[model samples]
Target: MPASALEGIDESTWVDVIQKMDEVYSQLIDDEIELEKKNAELEQSQQFIFSVLSAMSDVLLVCNERGVIEETNAALCELVGRTDAELHGTSLYELLADPLSVERARTVLGNTNPARRGEGLELNLFDAQRQSVPVDANCTPRVAASGRRVGTVFVARPTAEIKRAYHELRSAHEALKRAQQQLLHSEKMASLGRLVAGVAHELNNPISFVLGNVHALSRYSNRLRAYLAAVHAGEPAEQLQALRGKLRIDHILDDLPSLIEGTLEGAQRTADIVNSLKRFSAMDPEDRIPVDLNEVIKRAIHWIGKGAVPDFEMRWQPGPPLMVMGSAGQLQQVLMNLLQNAQDATAAHGKADKLVSIETEVVENCVRLHLRDNGPGIAPEHLSHVFDPFFTTKPVGKGTGLGLSISYGIVEHHGGVLSVCNQIDAGAEFLLELPLAH
Candidate 1:
């Protein structure tokens, strides 16, 4: 073969080599373009996920199998008083105030032995100050791409307001207790005053009669003495005997017994006034078993204190063991009325004398309790109608006027009575009568 012909014969090899190089270059370019597109898509997806997490206001946290924080949103920063960078990698145990909180959340997430127990759990968290804060927490076990449990995702919200609601309820309860106390005190005072005043007035008559008899006895005794003196002076027998007869000395002497009885009766009448007062106001209601009047009274005051009434000035007079038979509840109602009245009366008027006085004493199987207020005295005209139903000195809508009336009814039901009085000084008073325990 000629050399020129051979050279020309290499055309096939050159074409093949050129064709191979072009094909390889084309493939490389295509692969590079596909790789660039994939990288861009991945970056966009990452940006979208980050944006979603950062926009959320609620705290979201992710932890690894070891309970170490792997990811935290912007919200975690505000929740823990730290930045997301600071929160990441932090152990869940370190982030939580109580390790049990996390345990409880695990249970709620159905990670416990029985699994699938419930949805979520409410937890009370203690702040640095150890104050309770209500929080609702939920979690779910996280799975890796391989379908193995990796960690958990937790979301939480502060429940401080819920705890505040509970506290408010407790406060309301205390207020109720104070109100109950005041009502009982008022009732007792009102009932006692009425009965005592009536009985005292009635006893005056007997006392007067007894006093009259005593005066007569003394006069007769004087005459008998005079007659005897004449005899001792050695007067003529007829004259001495005449004097004795005219003086009625024998009759006078014989009448001494009657005279003494009259005096005793009069003194007894006076005593009856006080005794009746004691009986009327004594703390011995027929409806009740024995109870400590003092303790009951205290409860009444506490109940009333919760209202607009300011701190009351309470004066308790210690007396002999003041146990009485009365319905504690009803009696408490009465006392509540009286105490509220006193506080209200004083409240508008600036709590004059600034004192609420309580006294107890025992007399004749009854206990006498005096509930006195150093408030402005009741007007003379109003005193008579104070106990009347629907009669109130307070402005309209301020009171029902039934406070005293209902108290009166309660006392009556217990076989006792209630009343009020104007003190000689500037104040009003109420007395209660109840039966003494045998």
Candidate 2:
């Protein structure tokens, strides 16, 4: 029967049948190859996604509309002490540490809107040891390709970790602030060191006057004691008068008052100088007080002038008291820095008549102090960087370069502005402006 069936089919028909079968087989082979390639790509994608989820530090969960856990990352699995198989198909609410968290989770997961996103919800969950761990959780609605809401995706970070990070950041900030303050104090002390010579000279005048007055008073005391002893010895009045004339008692009595007054003045002056030095050398207090800029300028000039060369002169006509709110020591430091810089500039230029002139005026609600020097003007390229830290025109050991920089910062802290420029004629002028105290 099979031979009879084959005999009815012609050879060409059989050839066509064999060729169609070969074509069909070839097509099937190609399809199989394409399917293998697609399978390989899918496997690679799954591995990549798994690796990403495993590497993430935050806890991740994917749940269906019923709050049934469908997928979870390694972090979540490890946190709850469960395997992927155990976590799958479990109710997400079962892992919540409290009823409040369960209610919150239900509310977040129940929202079916595709555009809804829940963020920064503090939820507590049970860890492997059944201990509560607070987390900052974010929930976003998961949507299907057909635009239908299917489930929710949750990502959470531990609050303890975030708090630790914030604490560390605050500590670093405080440390940096302390370091900056120390640097400022170091620069201030360095400036004070440069004024030692001037301070010594300033102290010498008052101290020497006081000593001279004290010596004279001692001699007068001895003469008075001798005269009194003679009078008390019951000597005759003529003899006592002769003794008084010999000892110059009348002159001593007249000069005693003047000597005492001068001594007191000298002592007071010394005390004032010492107090100024103490204020300048001490750390600036945070409290601000009304300071007279004119007085500060005068003191700065007096101190800096004592150390200047014999030919150097500072001309200042203080008009009135310009009251500003700031640390007096800081303002004095700024003025001293300006004056010193002026003196240095003039001396460097080899000016025979070295002079620094200062003027103060009220402009609007601010006080402006202008200090000008007679010297070679600042270089065009150097003017812009004069207030930069570690920028100086003097020789290596002659300057620290922090003077103007620190002074600039001090003025700024006192609500002031300090700037420098080359005078049109020939010199450098510094302009300082500070707000007036109410």
Which candidate's TM-score is highest?
Answer: 2
lDDT for every model?
0.72, 0.86
Worst 10 residues of 1 by lDDT: 109-118
> Per-residue lDDT tens digits of candidate 1, residues 250-294?
787687777777667657655744542333344443445777888
Query: lDDT for model 1, on a 0 to 1 scale?
Result: 0.72
Q: What's the lDDT for residue 14 in model 2?
A: 84
TM-score of candidate 1 on Cα atoms, chains taken together: 0.37
Work out the TM-score per prediction: 0.37, 0.60
TM-score between candidate 2 and the true structure: 0.60
- Pairs of colliding residues, candidate 2: none
lDDT of 2: 0.86
- Candidate 2 minimal-lDDT segment of 10 residues: 276-285
